[model samples]
Target chain A: MHTSKVLVHNRDRSEIESEENYLPLNVLRLSKRFGGIHALNEVTFNIEEKSIISLIGPNGAGKTTFINVVTGTYPPEAGMIYFQGQNITGLPAHKIASLGIGRTFQLQELFLSLTVLENAMVGCHTRGRAGMFAAGLRIHPAKADEKRLREEAMENLKMIGLEQRASDSISSLPLGERKLVGMARALGMRPKLLMLDEPVAGLAAHEIENLVRLIHSLIDRGLTLFIVEHNMPFVMSISERVIVLDEGFKIAEGPPDDVRANEKVIKAYLGE
Target chain B: MKNSEIDRTHIPFIIMIAVIILLPIIIPSAYIISVMVFVAVYGVLALGMGILIGHAGLFSLAHPVWFGLGAYISGILAARGWVSPGIGIIVSAFFVALISYIIGAPILRLRGYYLACATFALLLIAQIAGGQLTNITGGHEGLLGIPPLSLGGFVFQTDLHYYFLSWALCIGCFWFCSNLIHSRVGRAIRSFHDSEIASKSMGVNIPKYKLQLFILTSVMASLAGSIFCFYLCFTVPSFFGFHLLVELLMMIVIGGIGSIQGPLIGSFVILWLRELIHIYFGKIFPVMTGEVDSIFFGILIIIVLIFMPRGLAGWVEQSFNLGRRTYAYFKGPGA
Candidate 1:
């Protein structure tokens, strides 16, 4: 319901009102190229603050590249990314991450040998302030940061219903659980925007149900979630809006039902 | 096995302190005592490298250079007679930290084999500098008249004194390092080992953390080297040479690569192996050579990699069931 369009571009800085309400993320004509292939070309979309939006497309539709560019994983050939109305394009991945954007890998990139809680704690790196000296000495600030990180990580694991297994080795968890742990780890960053890449790519029906519930809970907690997934039913059921991409271009964008019924989206999925 | 890796680093350290206190009293044999002293010095060296290669999964062959530089800097500074050896060691550490920062900033950009090779080249260059810089290093004859470490006017006069000092320093380093590894920076450094992408997305500044750990490892090596300087009362180009790197690599592999205790345990194993070779294989060759240690180290490394990639320390950690029982026993029924 909070879905919006890109309403401002190349505007004079003096005229931009600080008091105006803004989307959490806004992108303008993002483009990426690998040699001759246009992995992403002139794609544009804006995510509303604290809304659940789904991005879906057929294989090789540049869904992953789009997310990678937006999250600063891949350098865009040309584009401007605005996070909370500040230009974030061309920033390094960690810099962008520290600016309140968190993402999970398509293949869950959980630290395999560490405990689940530790994995989440590592995600809270940007939030902590103790340097090597402070950490090594375990001084007041360092101790407090570490203690706070543990609590934050534990809180995230609890939020994801994984506090019981917090001490369990990450590798011991099943794939679905590992993905959730990855989400919990990303949550440790306490990002304004949390992006999930193919969050339910390989989940059972019950796992999907659990993930849907988790997503809804995250939304209820006043967090924006940008999910790149292929599960049409899951997307339609959970997403307030869906943006359809094909061949590195946005084909349709609207409420999930409208996007689902759009002829362009149908053609993109089933072909002409 | 469940969580021993995190908890067990301290157990060996405490046991090592007890051993450090008891060993000099029990063994009293000068030659064996000196070897144990070598274990302490090299143990610190290995701990430094362990953080780099073991926990952070960095490959570096340049640690010996840092150690050598620490020795020379501390030796040169302490040799002046005005500054205390303790001050000399501290100054040497800062120098090594600065130098490592300057060098690491560029070298860490090269990943895997390239990084290893860059560090290897650095080792060779530093070795050459040690030999050629005669005015400063005193060349092959070694810098002479370097005083023993003195604190509050009590001078250490013998190997026994150094054994206590070196092991004490080793214990101190271990304590701080253990604290470090349990802290947030430690987790950040370890995160780089498995998932750079995940760590990056977590807002971990990978390059910064890498360089920070690099400098810390170098500083630890500098500390060890400084102690080595004070203990020897002289400096040599050969003390921190290429062979020392090979020896350190063997210690890391044999002891266990990642954990803090790995290097200390590996240092003990290698030293014991040296003593064994001296007892048994010394008769086979009229003149002992570095080649001898190489053959033994190469074979041991292969055996370690194949049988237990984690090394002896890892093995100890795996069978820490005995340790847990002992710990539980000491703590009482409820604890």
Candidate 2:
């Protein structure tokens, strides 16, 4: 229903007003090249605030490369990324993250040696202000800060129903649970936009359902989600808008039903 | 559960403190006391290396260079009566900290074996500088007659006095390190170690944390070297050589790489084993001489690696958990 309100690219006052009211992320003329191969070629898009969107492409369609460039894992050869209407292209990964962008890896990158609680607490690194000296001396304010950090981490774990397993080592958790932990950790950053790379890739049907429900709850809380996933049914069911990519080209972009009906998307998935 | 975890972690630290206090009273032999003093000195150095290698996962072979620099700086200052031994320690620590930051800024950017090779090159360069800078270092003949550490009226002259002083300093360093490892920065260091990508995504500045830990480790190593110089009332280039570096590395590996108690326990184990091997092997073999100790140490380390890959602290922790589980099993679920 919210996708119906998305403005088409135009200079009209009504379109400008709609863009200003909802747009949180805008990537323009993003391009990345590896030697002779163009991994991403002049791709451009904008994400509305608090909207759940899915990016779907066949293997090697530059989906991962696009995410990497946007998140500052790899700098785009040419492009500008604007978050909340400010230029943020080519910043370092940590700086980008501190600017309210959080991401999870395709293969879960949980701190395996640390406990679930600690892994989530690490996500709260940007929020805490206590320095090494303050922490080492056990300064009263630092202690209180640490207490608050723990509570916040716990609250994040609870969001994904993982607070009960907070003290368990990450290595002890199952794959599905580990993915949830990764999501919880990202949530701990309190990011305005959460980017998930293949969040439901290895989950069972029931687990996928649970994750979809959790994601819906997160969207309801005014958090925007940019999901890159291969599961078309799940993506179509949950994402208000779906963007299709084919070999680094933006082939289709619209509401899920409209994009599903596009011949280019069908050809991209079924092959030429 | 939180209270119980804190109590469990503190047990080893409390036991270590009790052992340090009881050792001099129980032994009282000057030879044994001096040997224990060496353990405390080396333990401090190993703890520094442990923080670098264990927490940050950086392999720095140039630790002895900082250690040597600390000793030579303190030795030169004390010999000239420019500053007291207390001031010497603080001055040398800051000096090393500054140098390490400058060096680490570039070096910490590198990863794995490249970083190791770069640091190793630094060690060789420092050793050469020690010999070539004859006016300052005294070259191969070594700096001598550095005055005993004293505070106004009291002089730390005897082995017993130095023993308590070194252990006290060692304990203080341990307390600082333990506190640091539990702090927010420490968590960031460990997270970076486990997953650099994840840590960076969580807004942890990887290079900044690595360089900070590197500087901290260097400062601690320098302080230990200063105390070691005062303990012997002299300094030597040979004291801060490749052999000592290897010994410091062995202490961390043998004690348990990441645990707080690992370096301290490792220093005691390696030093005691070396002494025992030297004393007994000389009498038993008669012909093998000093070579037997190295051969035995090699074999012992190999055996330790094969049996306990995580090191002694890990083994101790595993057994501690096993004990707790068995006790709970006998007590039943509700009890």
On residues A1-272, what C-alpha lDDT tens digit does candidate 2 reach at each position? 33332232222224434555546788876889988888898788889988998999999999888888988888998767877766678989889889899999898889877899998998888888787777766687567778888999999999899999999998889999999999988987799999999999989999999999999898889899999999989999999899988888899999999999999999989978
Each predicted complex: what DockQ? 0.78, 0.65
What is the per-residue lDDT of model 2 for residues B1-335, given as tens digits with 9 covering 90 to 100? Answer: 98997698577568878988898789878999999999998998899888888887898888998888888888888888899877888888899999999999999898989999999999988988888888887888888779988777588889989888888878878877887788777888889888898899889989888988888878877877887888887776777888998888888888988887899889999999888887888798888756887787788778779988778988899999999999999999998
Tell me the whole-model lDDT of each prediction, alpha carbons only. Answer: 0.86, 0.86
lDDT measured at residue B78 in model 2 versus the true structure, 0 to 100: 87
Docking class of 1: medium
Instruction: Tell me the spans in candidate 1 whose CA falls farther than 4 Å from its real position.
Output: A1-9, A12-19, B1-12, B80-82, B322-335
Pairs that collide in candidate 2 are: none
Predicted candidate 1 versus true structure: per-residue lDDT over A164-210, tens digit per residue: 99999987899999999999999998898999999998889999999
Predicted candidate 1 versus true structure: per-residue lDDT over B1-335, tens digit per residue: 83786468568667877887888788788888888888989998998888789889889889999999899898898887757887888888999999999999999988889999999999888888888888988888898989888878889888898888888878888887878888988888888788888888888889998998899889888988988888888888888888799888889988988787788889889988988887777778748745686688788899999987999988877779678989999999998
Q: After superposing candidate 2 on the true structure, give the runs of residues whose Cα lies further than 4 Å from its correct spot.
A: A1-22, B1-11, B286-289
Q: lDDT at A122 for candidate 2?
A: 89
Each prediction's TM-score versus the true structure:
0.92, 0.94
